[model samples]
Target chain A: MTTTAQTRAHDAANLGLLPIFMAAAAGLTLLYFTGFAQASVYHDSAHDTRHTLAFPCH
Target chain B: MTTRIFASALFAGLLAGLVAVLLQWSLMEKLILEGEEYETGAKSHFAGVLKLNEDGETAEQAAESGDGGEEEGTTRRFALAFFATFVTWVGWALLMVAGFALTERYGVRITMKDALVWGTAGFGAIHVMTGIGLPPELPGQPAAEIELRQMWWITTAATAVIGFALMGYGRKPFHFAAGIALLIAPHLIGAPRLDDYSGMAPPELSGEYVARSYAVAFISWIVLGLAAGYFWNRLQQPPA
Candidate 1:
């Protein structure tokens, strides 16, 4: 019983797919806005950063 | 568990973002600002010599007509720069943490030491691989269309990430072979480019910008890896 309980605890400690997917989605959105967004406002605001980070920019 | 993962990512991401902003301020900001002078025609690469535009006006005259638009206030510009850098690093951190968690689920052990390796891999995928085609550009550097370049950049980074992940996690020889192919495929497709390599900024300035950008990115990624690894380990521990 103790071995089974411990095994269950260990498995629970590992992360699930949902949270990982959510994090990835959020990250991609933020990266897209900061690095790749083409709006002139975004381009103007992030001009120097776009250059420094090597993002494609005018 | 989900909350804990996000909390850890937030803390680590913010910390790394702060480091990246400070590094950018010190190392790269001046060069960018200087390059902008050329970009805006506030300064000319040819010094005293005047270049006539297609309209037959001198470059200086065209600049005086306000073609480049008004410069943003210094404070506002600085704020924007800081915000962009912070957002970028946070995004990268979240991705890294997610990667760590996913890999752990797949029977890979994620120690603080391993996180550093992960961080380096992130840098390799995002910067080094993409850089081979695009390199880095200065303000006035001639380039292909933004949309085309952006698409290529996204594709390259994506392929590199998947390629690296497969190589790192895959069990079969076929997986590794596929990973290598993915890594090479983007470069084989090539990045969008222009026929001419012309730019208003001096070649020396552009060269310096590329070199410094890579150096700053490397340091930031290393710091990000260390901080994320430390936090990931710390947060995973059960309360005493």
Candidate 2:
């Protein structure tokens, strides 16, 4: 029972790094589109929001 | 666990984003639209006072002129704003949740209170720290080149984030001092700036816009923190 508890604790702590990396990648991509994309369409579309959120905008 | 984290992030982000967009529409959109009038020359600051038109047309008179086919454009813009804001919040949520997970791996469990602290750190890094060099701007506000400003803004935010992380996690005095230094380094380097400060919009209007934007951002970020924390706790509970 002690061994099982230890193993469960180990597994719980070992939540792995992959999810963190994947989430970071996805998050950065979305942020780029909303806040930093240079395309005129993106700019025009997100103009007010970009300004409202204090993102750099034309 | 991964799926749970993502699910928590998505739900929290959606809730926060909804609140943020509603707040934006009610509190901030009008200032932006008014600023755009100056930006597009639909209303001119000088024209209003000087009566620049041959027919003595004031800026208010010019503004009174309506644009055609704006209904379609307004609808499109509104849709875009909604989507962008939602995406932005989700992105923030994902990043924050990932941070939470990473910290947990190092033996730091994030409670709802801890999540609120993280959210404040986020606001400090992304909004307050960056805004020190680059305050919120109106549509017609003068600025440096976009690329340069963006580079500085990103650098400041990254440094601030790292700095905050160190301060939060580091046990040593050196580490804390290093974090403080990192926090100050970007400001010391300075943000890119225009040679002259001239804007189409009046200064009072611009001031109000900046103030209101910060107010809105603060409230939204607090809500985001609470929502993220609540969801994070809710999802992490063991199945009954």
How badly does each model clash, as a count of residue pairs? 0, 0
Index of the highest-DockQ prediction: 2
Write candidate 2's Cα lDDT for B42-77 as tens digits.
677775344334345555575466466677888888
- Residues B18-79, candidate 1: write the lDDT tens digits: 97788789888899888877776666788786656556666567767754544557668879
Worst 10 residues of 2 chain B by lDDT: B47-56
TM-score for the second chain in candidate 2? 0.90
Clashing pairs in 1: none
Quality of candidate 2 docking, DockQ: 0.73
Reference-based lDDT, residue B57, model 1? 67
Q: Which ten residues in a row are the worst by lDDT in model 1 chain B?
A: B66-75
Error of 1 at B79 (Å): 0.9
